[model samples]
Target: MPEVKRKYVTPGELVGKGRYNRTSNVYQIEDKFYSTRVGMAEVINDSLRVIPLTGPYIPREDDLVVGKIIDHSAFAWEVDINSCFSSFLLAQSVFGRDYSPARDSLTKKFAIGDLVTAKILAFDRTRDPLLSVSGPGLGRINQGEIVSISPTKVPRVIGKKGAMIKTIENYSKCRLTVGQNGLVMISGNPEGIILAKSALDLINHEAHTADLTQKVQDLLSGSNNGEKE
Candidate 1:
């Protein structure tokens, strides 16, 4: 595997050129790639992409996100997805063919303040994004504490091939469900949940550091040792 070179860049800063191709949050002029936003530039295997350091969550199809129910209409419930745009969870999306908003109360099924894990079915800048909770691992989050972090740091928390998250779960002895929109739900032993939250905080604080993985491991190890003593 190639070592990825990561660096922070400002708007219009040169990201890469030549063999490096641009991805999200960047632009190209001829052969030169430049960042269009304030973000971290990542170069991996001939591909270069900039991850925005600060911005609202841009909804993409099939993204599993954690959302809080804020309001409801006769046919759909409004969800705050930790983004500038709110999402809509329709009654039909939840109940399929049996759904009848007139016959059934939408609030009865999902009340305000309920945290839900749902998928983005469709998203359009002009209209509110559509969401669904019909898939596996997608539903009401009844147990667990929700932790919020910067959306850009989500990938780092997950790590490559889920190694970082696995490490956190093992060390904390907690079951974690991470949403792309920066909401994480931790469930298990109360102590483990606290440890998990602490681990996530460390990851968020040092996301730009190259040795972040090792630092996280060290942090967890120290926490575990304290518990033993």
Candidate 2:
């Protein structure tokens, strides 16, 4: 396998010249791939994707997201997933098939201002995304401090094969639940949480850097009692 390299790219720039097994944020013309926006172009193995430096989180099916309950209707609760489009969590999803608006109050399960970690059940260009909290580690975020970064930086935050997150969690003694939509829930001691947030900030600003994982490890390992410098 060839070594993967990430490069800054601009709109209409030629990203690659090959058949890719997967692609994102780039259009292909024949055997060439052209970037669709200003961002970082990455080619790993047979996959090619341009991680846009600036953009809203586009909803994709099965994306884990942390969202805020902004409003509620009779049928569903509206959640702000930090995207241009709001998402819906139906009452039936939480209350079973026989749920009733009068008998089963939506607010009872999730109220305004509550944060939840959910999965994008379904989404298409035609309708608002649907959410489900019916899985392991998915539901109202009752604890932890929330930290948000650019959605595009999520892949970098997770690192290659979970190295970055593992480093932070192991060194800082914090558990990080990162959302594809850019929201992060850091749960641990106060000091550990502070250190974790600092690491996340560093990753967000320096995602394009090649040695970011090492930098984050240094940041975590060098912190004294998890105090911010």
Candidate 3:
């Protein structure tokens, strides 16, 4: 087994050589590999990859995301998924045959400024993302304030097996829906909402630090005590 090197890398920097397969945001020339983006490099076993610290969210199929309605056409509505590229939710995808432009207005169904939780149906670099609200846990979000964070920090917020997020919910007494695109919807008491937002901010600020789970736990515990006193 080869030792995995974990470190920050810059563009054009050598990642690894020979027998290591390169993946995501890196380029290869023969057996030698180089990074094409600025990120942290992770080498595990025979696989090597880069995790970008900053970049636009590249949509992937089946990704659950939170978005705001930005614009609408006769048959579809455009959504801002906190990415450089916008997504489209077709009328038929949401309303099926009940969507009738002649008798019903698209705006009335999904007006601008409405927040939604949707699933990506398809995505390619050349085309806008296709979204759907037909699955479980997918639909219009009527309440709660949305908080934005760096998309790269989503995994940290989620933590191992959802430990970190569950901690936030318990401490703040807020029910949260976290989107992979870095949008979090908080629903509960005003004080709990504020505490949840603060915890999320802490995660975003210290995602790269070690013992992050412990740090988030300590923060939540301290806040919970303050609320009781």
Candidate 4:
């Protein structure tokens, strides 16, 4: 009856089932003839993109993430970026040098519990994605603890690119990276980090909600108001 933005569509049925009308980026409900976006829904005939409520974190291309230094070695530091598998950050990829030769690395710059801000360089069907901290204004993180969430929910936090994150940053008085693969790194005063993490968790939980922007605004407003009183 009414046309809406493309993002509003939900999953329809399994893919390749030879059912449902294909239109634009969505499949339509044969009965209602309503078009919907493709993802995380049944396609009737084709396999759907619907994921379980919870699944292993999968990394996609160009995901910005917060990396937690878990273990260190002579060559690279091991980081858990909330991916299906943890990733490695080579010393060369980062500005600070543990050393040179590529054989003996210095892990002192990063250690267990320290969080680093980085971006995914490459992700393939197999093997872990390579990450980098070499981008402009990007490098080893200075402070704060990393917060993790469902990879799918990352979009909600980032908000149609970077708009959503900018709001959270302004509201919480914290700096953060909403990673492509759902890895979030929060840095600021300890209190700010905690507040940022709380906001992140709520966004992840309510990703499918309508009026997401409004919901987040309300959440932040309530929190700030509570602090003042």
Candidate 5:
């Protein structure tokens, strides 16, 4: 995907000239498209549109997301996706039509304050994003330290599979969970989690390095020996 730089649209500025409502992205301006509100401009091929910096997260289909369970019922759980509206995961949506597991089990199907990883199945543009938990590798989180950072750095954290993630895992001997929106959860023994979290943070701060391998190795060794913070 080509990168789009975010800019600002001045008040009363007509960046989009389209006659219809274009996508919310600030980069594209067409006929009937004009600034609906004052906010950041998503630069699109020499044009700009407006969108508020603080807005509801509108989930697109297949978008991997991190959500918090705020409400629960015997049949479903409602998640606050850090968006304008909350989402819901029906029991069937999580376990599937035929998959069966005792609800009373301590597997943490979901409970208030529990964080979960899931795929956005659909966005009811009319409502909150619809998320699903039935897909492979989708389920409750186990053992991890949740760290926070700027959402823009997600792509850097998850370099090509995971070549970046793999490096962290190998060095820290821990598993890391990086939410696309910049919510990271690192899990392992206390020492391992700390090492993994710090290493990942290093990667974020120093992504410009062309030779990352040696630096990663050195960091791992230092972390293991408790050489420095």
Candidate 6:
């Protein structure tokens, strides 16, 4: 396995000089790659990218997002995924191909203000994102406390190989589903949920700091008086 290198970088900083199979959030200057934003730069074997530390959520294909149903047209429901654009979940995605507006009422399935965990099916500069909730763990979010953080800090919340999230879950005894949009849905006892949220807040605030994983572990291990649910 090729070794990976990661470091915080500012815009215009030199990232590396080498041929890479994939590179993003960076511009190539001949064989050299330069950072395009203030964020974490990662060089993984043949791949390279900068994960921005602060930015609006940009819709990407296959992104798991937690969104709220804000409005609905005859054919699709508009979802606010905490991005510059509102995404649309088509009726055909939820209902069958032969769906009828008269027979299939959109509100019957998901009403306005309903929170949904969905995937981005398609997106481009020309149109708003298209979404789908027709898979395992996708659909209306029935219950759970939602906690939001900066979208860029999502990777930190998840931790290396999911170690941070697993640590929070193990210590707080909460089930957390994190959306790339920086939304997290936590379900467990009220006390556990409170504890998990605190951990998430810590991660969001100190994502750029060193030894973050250890800090999160320490926070989770400490006493947490349950907040009022």
Q: Look at candidate 6 and give me any clashing residue pairs.
A: none
State TM-scores per candidate.
0.90, 0.90, 0.90, 0.68, 0.63, 0.88
lDDT of each: 0.88, 0.92, 0.86, 0.66, 0.66, 0.92
lDDT accuracy of residue 26 in candidate 3 = 83
How well is each residue in 102-140 modelled by candidate 2, as lDDT tens digits? Answer: 898898899999999999999999999999999999999
State the weakest 10-residue window (summed lDDT) of model 1.
220-229
Please count the clashing residue pairs in each candidate, in the order shown. Answer: 0, 0, 0, 21, 13, 0
lDDT per residue for candidate 6 within 138-214, as digits (tens), equals 99998889999999999899988999999999999999999999999998999999989989999988898889887
User: Model 4: per-residue lDDT, tens digit, 1-229?
Assistant: 3332223334453233334444333444443333243343334332233423344567766767777788876667788887667787777666455457555435556777777777778778887777787777566677566677887677677888788888888888988866666677777887777767777877877777669788677777664555531
| Model 3, residue pairs in steric clash | none
Residue-level lDDT of model 3, residues 1-229, one tens digit each, is: 6777798899999988878643777888998889877788888887889887777777889988999999999899999999888999999887787878887788878899999999999999789999999977788998887999888889888888998889999989998888999998888999999889988998888787778888778777774455531
The lDDT-based order of candidates, best leading, equals 2, 6, 1, 3, 5, 4
Q: Please tell me which model should have the higher TM-score, number 3 or number 5.
A: 3
Better of 1 and 2 by lDDT: 2
Candidate 3: where are CA atoms >4 Å away? Answer: 1-4, 223-229
* Tens-digit lDDT track of model 5 for 79-101: 86665667887777766676445
Using lDDT as the measure, name the better of candidate 5 and candidate 6.
6
Model 2 alpha-carbon miss at residue 8, Å: 2.3
Model 4 misplaced stretches (Cα beyond 4 Å)? 1-53, 95-104, 223-229
The per-prediction CA RMSD against the true structure, in angstroms, equals 2.9, 2.6, 3.1, 6.3, 6.3, 3.2
